[model samples]
Target: MKKNMDDVRFWPGNIVVAEAAVAAGCNFFGGYPITPSSEVAAHMALLLPKVGGHFIQMEDEMAAMGTVIGASLAGAKSLTATSGPGFSLKLENLGFGYIVEAPCVVVNVMRGGPSTGLPTQPAQADVMQARWGTHGDHPTIALTPAFHQEIYMETIRAFNLAEQFRMPVILLLDEVLGHLSEGVIPPKPGSFEIINRTKTTASPEDYVPYDTSEGDVPPFAPYFAGYRWHTTGLNHDRTGFPTTDPDTVTFDEKRLMRKVTGNRELIDKVEYFQADDAEIGIFAFGSTARAAMVAVKQARAKGIKAGLMRPLTIWPFPNNQVLAFSKQVKTIIVPEMNLGQIVYEVERSVHSDMPIHRINRVGGVPINPSEILAGIEEAA
Candidate 1:
């Protein structure tokens, strides 16, 4: 397909976020229906066809992820969106995408819950799930956007990261961020970068799906059309075959890890407000980060040197950044909808430096800005 550089259409931020994936060349979606995150799938259902993409509502979350991996293996930019419970169910295939280094996007519109805790209420309980939900050792990129505009822009960015690293990227949005409607002007037509998968027309005699070249991400050729490729859940070599050969296994496993994990500079993004010359740092992500922002602004009004640290990329937690801030700040405030998930990461990253204070609300409501301000005050 020839690249279309023509200026496209502009849309509302919510619609633009959902539709931008199609514009960014994402054509396949497979997901089970769930609240909050469902809008992404729903939006794709209506919007994908106009751009020649495909949407499949599978029987369940696991199958949804499986379908995406299959579509991506066939050279399609694919994705799936879900929330808390749905995310838990998809871990197996999420791991599959990691082992195979399949390029796709998974959106988690976080809601309150261990098991269907709160459906409509907004919560950021899935922070660690977005990070370590899948088992074993593998690298993943997760982006948390705090508002409606971010939902659109972040989704586009997620697709790009997935293609560049040859791995699945997760867009971590909470219910508040997913459903929040705010006016936003999308990028002008032809302003977006749509990355397509790299395809090689190698002959049937010499092609391996996991063949490692100079890059951390090995080049892949699709099945059928004479390219013989084998994919599995077990650790394997570049030929994609099961093997216990320790050296080959170690190299392949670490290669998979380095493909995304080693490229943190390219993937690390955050929003900093009042960070410079601040005595306190309020660390947060997703929707909670929005409240943190307001709290930081209010703190500054009261002559408190407090800053908001929002990690736009959450999975590869910004440890180095946190360490730098911890050394400079007197206190750190970590808040979320969950009891104590991300706070643990913050604690670990900073070596328990300074006072690590936590204010969390787990009853299914988004902790308001005022409450966060009170927490910051208490820390101060």
Candidate 2:
């Protein structure tokens, strides 16, 4: 049998992410090899050079993150990939990216662990860490994709959100989804819009890297591009110089946060399946959402009103959508690979006596559809 090669392509999940990043105009990759996510860097190493992009295996995870930030500041669409342990190592630099608003994508193909618990197994435990692993009240944008095709598209969106908001965007993938083989039909070139960071048109003499006069997200001026501005981890004024003044510090902090929070409508993405008039709402994400969707279908067949709300953009958390979904459903079932991370968020979102059940699994395995369906049945 001859298969059509016109629009069909088979790739492992990590390769899809790499190819998608390239398609999104990512020109630089600096990542350390870690299990489940190593394929992303390996494929990036092979693909980037073909497009006149650069790929570097850094000394370690921390350096990998630093290189990505530097490359992004030098006018490159930069990215890095890692798993749980490496993700932890990259947090300090990740926080720096938030403070300086460097545009880059960080891919965390999540495996089990607080500290290298399961290097080769799947887990959705990094959802909270992606949002708050770094210190301070900085902004965060994270996208979680369940399938190979979503991995491809969401990886591109990760780069887009990073460049658009001038901060690091995290692409979170469970180990199962990262290692799975699946077919993807990517859109043709120019089929969709790709975003690049807004560059400053101000002359060299008038460059201000953190200027908020125009909007919350300031135009970026790449280094060595005849533009000079200070970049620091400390709170800084519009000149990008460190400031201790209360007013300037306050203003800088608020703007950094508001860039993402104020644009929640643009950044938040939640997928609802069979949710309308659902009696039992299941909240899940990453690969677990995939299972939950199956559970919803099965429940519907069994004469149960089940729905699934999958948060594609994890941070920013899609609280509004969850709240609205809560109003329509009598109960919400939270299922995830971790012990119980996002369930707390669901409880907070509903903010009522609504019965929210949990179907959590740890120890390096995915939560299956049957388990979720059982949860739905119990809830019903």
Candidate 3:
């Protein structure tokens, strides 16, 4: 198909995320409007129906999350978008999505906050929240991108991972990336990958919704599709019936966790820039990585060996890679828009006692490239 001029134009990161979700076969979007993330909801509201999909602006973030989970259960690829305060509201339903193993996407365009700290400003404070905001011990898969184009691509990848794993996946963006605009050449139709949830092939009477003989992940049959199965937040058996047996509870919890932990090799991803021969390494993610990259270049120009290790997949925390990189660098510097979330991960990953410097900023402004460069130079 020939590309139209309009198709390769610049777009804000949030808008691109919405478009990418649509291209990834998402047919349902249920979310409430929130700063930095509202554009995503608005775009979906306008575009989803045009493509024969469903879009709902719910009364609150909790309802928005519930709607998406229900839609996913009904065989529609669903998504929701929100910021910090709204994200907190969706935690309960997010936990429900986890236990039920519903396949859906949740985009959190992060804003400063413990309680609406800076609604319209950017911050990476929610990094830890994206991993542990929901209750219980379920596994999580989250992807962060640095630029507008990456935001577009990662949104599609988030949906694919959610479907492939039969769980909710998070695309973590901050105000900077969410509202930033840049020219992006949209992927050609059908050129990108799209994954749908696996369907059970067993007879209705024999179907077990949580059956795991296939692997840690069970085949999922859409609700009301001749596969009558029970699903609840309560611990359940392979038949999806509520259970109180210790062994069943233990096995169910492990299954929920292992589907992600056991498959870490397939899900973990990182981007290493100039790290092969660096004396100093900078660790960053999301939009913070953009400035980190620039800082790496500045350090190089100043005759200092510096590089960057940016996590594309934040959860499942990239431990092995961080450990390996730690061995190669004399010191590590972590610069984030928050007062230090991922720095703790880096500290835990380094087996050898290496000096780890934390350069944090939580006042809604991003850590500048100069600040990162200074940290790198000091570490060197």
Candidate 4:
């Protein structure tokens, strides 16, 4: 497919995200429609088949997640999109993906939550959930984009990282970013790098799906690629067979985490605005980061040395960057649509003596520039 560089389209964030997936060579989409995220599924359903790919609207979120995992294992780059309620249902299978090291992308367009609080509203309440929702010590790579263009770019990055690291990657969007429409320049073919999973070169009898002797990440072969291997949610050994030996279990857990944590330099990313000499830093992510950027500009215009630190990759949290920024600032202010989820990580990274203030808004309303600016002023 050729793209016209001279053409521009005002695309909703969800559509752009699906376009990115298609551009990244995503050949299979297994997802059920849900609010604020259904457009992603709709777009995929329309586009995937046109590109010789497959799309399926599963019976439910759980089935949707399972389908994607199956597709990925069969050598297809697969994806799924969902909202908070659907996201909750995906957690169990998400863990399965982690354990099996299936490369796929799961996009969560966050809405007001905790038992369907607000279906059409936006919230950042899922920050911590994205990190620890699966209930394990496994490493997670989650990217949060603040704008439509970023929604497109990061969706591509999510697939690349998933395939590279051989684990499920989350593209965390919010209701605002998912539903908002904005003009965007789609990337031309061959403009951006696309990564595919590495396949093993060893003979079938010698192949070990979970081997770590070469490195933390084992090269994976497609299920039907003449390689027969066992996979389970239970602890597994180098050959992919289930095991409960204490040594094997501990080794497997460490390798699972090391694939992501040990390579944080390559996977973790952040955007810093006016942060070099600022005394007050505003920490945020996702849609909240967009408003925080505006607030920082306003604060700077008013002679306050306020800057913004927006983490593009939320998990495997950027501890070093946050701590270093903390030392250079007197206070750090974190604003989110949730009631202080990321602030806890900020507090843990910053010096105990440094004041940390959180500006939280819940019940579907977004945190506006005024609220963040006020917090900046109060911190200053």
Query: Clashes in each model (backbone N, CA, C under 3 Å)?
Result: 2, 0, 0, 0
Query: How do the residues 1-380 of candidate 3 rate in per-residue lDDT, one tens digit apiece?
Result: 44466767678889999999999999999999999899999999999989999999989999999999999999999999999999999999999999999999999999986897899899999889999998889899999988776787888889989999999999999999888888778788788888888888888888888889999889988888888878788999988889999999999899889989988887898998998899899899988899999999999999999999999999989999999999999989998888888899999999988999999998888889999988887777
Residue 332 in model 1: lDDT: 90
Inter-residue clash pairs, candidate 4: none
Local accuracy of candidate 1 as per-residue lDDT tens digits, 58-117: 989999999999998888889888888999999989999989888999888788867987
Clashing pairs in model 3, backbone N/Cα/C closer than 3 A: none
For TM-score, candidate 2 versus 3, the one ahead is: 2
**Any runs in candidate 3 off by more than 4 Å, and if so which?**
1-7
**Model 2 CA deviation exceeding 4 Å by range:** 1-3
TM for candidate 1 is 0.93
**What tens-digit string does per-residue lDDT give for candidate 2 at 1-380?**
24467777888899899999999999999999999899999999999999999999989999999999999889999999999999999999999999989999999999987888899999988889999999999898999988887888888899889989999999999889888888888878898679988888899999888877889989888899899878889888888888899998888888889999899988999888988779899999888998998999999999999999998899988888899999999999999898899999999999689998989899897899999999888989
- Error (Å) of candidate 2 at residue 373 is 1.0
Arrange candidates by TM-score, descending: 2, 3, 4, 1
Cα RMSD for candidates in order: 4.1, 1.6, 1.9, 2.2
Q: In angstroms, how far off is 147's CA in candidate 4? A: 1.7
Q: What's the lDDT for candidate 3?
A: 0.91
lDDT of 2: 0.91
